[model samples]
Target: MRADLDIEGGVVVGIDGSDASLHALFLASEEAGRRDCLLHVVRAWTLRTAPRPPEVPPSTVPSVAEFHDWIVLRTRALVEETLPAPEDRARVRLHLPRSQAVGALLTAAETAELLVVGHRGRGSRLMLGSVAAICVRRAGCPVLVTRPHHRRAAGRRATAGG
Candidate 1:
């Protein structure tokens, strides 16, 4: 693990602006609060790997600096708003690495107590995104992949309990 990647036994989570990733952030924050630990959110990006609009021209694509700024601005707000309590938000520490998601997440979780991620990211339509799949298989710490509750199942459970 790189010295900079050490989170001092915090909870690490990867966020990609996806609903699943947002839930993962919430779960990580809640878990971190429960454990009295920091919540480290990873937003990995690089020009080589950053997603771009299909219709955008190559020359008009956003540069790495632009991309970084966008992610920081957008994701910071998302993270801040997702956690319900101020104290929970205070415990969050963002990790913006200029690398691939899988590598960034694995390294960030090296010294963390747990790692959380979405089941699927924006880049993929499959049930499991490659990054989450690799992290689950290779992260040094245990990985928790978040999945949103199914509405029908939730309704059934709610009515059953009543």
Candidate 2:
């Protein structure tokens, strides 16, 4: 992950490979571009997804620095998918902190001008996912929770059928 030191007055957005998150990313990019600030794209993670490390001499705590390779690739791909253009994607600074989603995003928000997140994530069934809801309430900066827009098929209005 990029893991930049910190961002000041920039736009921060959290991504989780969900449609809602894609929309949030788009909105966050637009907002960041409009404000002429960096876009801090974050996808925090924990060790739960990691596989057990191999046995050592039983004299030290095992650790792996690169266990989050998939997260980095996935997050980068999502950002590229949303931003499309190479130049647009290049301007964004991606962060994948070894932390819970809310805490990571909130930490990023400490110096950010705004924080953006999806209304819900991959497995959330609520109108606003627990992560987004908590971030909205606790972020140091203004938080924007984005919901995906569903477009209806266009057709002629009902008049008469023969």
User: How does each model score on TM-score?
Assistant: 0.81, 0.78
CA lDDT of each candidate?
0.79, 0.76
**Candidate 1 lDDT by residue in tens digits, 1-162:** 222454668899998888888878877887998999889898887776565644457879776667777677877788867765688888888888877788888888778899999999876788888989999999999988877565853464366441
Name the candidate that leads on TM-score: 1
Question: For residues 60-102, what per-residue lDDT tens digits would candidate 2 score against the true structure?
Answer: 6445564476677677777877788676676699887777777
What value does the lDDT take at residue 56 in candidate 2?
35
Against the true structure, candidate 2 reaches a TM-score of 0.78
Score candidate 1 by lDDT. Answer: 0.79
